[model samples]
Target: MGFESVSDFLAMGGHGLYVWLSYAIALVVVVLNLIAPLRTKKQIHKEQARRLRREQSQI
Candidate 1:
């Protein structure tokens, strides 16, 4: 299972579209999995800070 050239590797025995699309989807899922948690944490921290400010102002 060896490719003599880059084009051969990319073509992937005529299944290139499916293979590449699957890889692209997997990569996007991995990226989103990473980003979603960080985004949620940031949003939570922002809300907490606002809550604290509101509490302090009430005193």
Candidate 2:
């Protein structure tokens, strides 16, 4: 873990492409895991609001 520079650190013992790609894919999956739940929550809230409004209108 004692690389002289940023380039050397990222080079990862000449496996840079595979290492960086794995990191990128991991990041994407984590971000999607976070985002998907929030999106579903928003959809649920919208549906609940619509249902409430319909019930109010019926009364």
Candidate 3:
């Protein structure tokens, strides 16, 4: 099962839409999984900094 050209390979025997879409969705999910934790960590750092500043200002 060999494709003679790039187009044929992408077509994937006329199931290209499902195949490519699934790949794209999987990629997005993987990227989000990576990013979500970093974003959450940043948010937590920001909140902690704000709380520390407030406590220092009170003193």
lDDT of 1 by residue, 1-59 (tens): 99989999999999999999999999999999999999999999999999999999999
TM-scores of all models?
Answer: 0.97, 0.84, 0.95
Best by TM-score: 1
- Best-to-worst ranking by TM-score: 1, 3, 2
Q: What is the lDDT of residue 14 in candidate 1?
A: 94
Write one digit per residue (lDDT tens) for candidate 3, span 1-59.
99989999999999999999999999999999999999999999999999999999999
lDDT of 1: 0.98
* The 10-residue segment with the lowest total lDDT in model 3: 1-10
Task: Report the lDDT of model 2 for residue 53.
Answer: 100
RMSD of every prediction: 0.5, 1.3, 0.7
The TM-score of predicted model 2 comes to 0.84
Residue pairs with clashing backbones, model 3: none
Across 1-59, the per-residue lDDT of candidate 2 in tens digits comes to: 79999999899889999999999999999999999999999999999999999999999
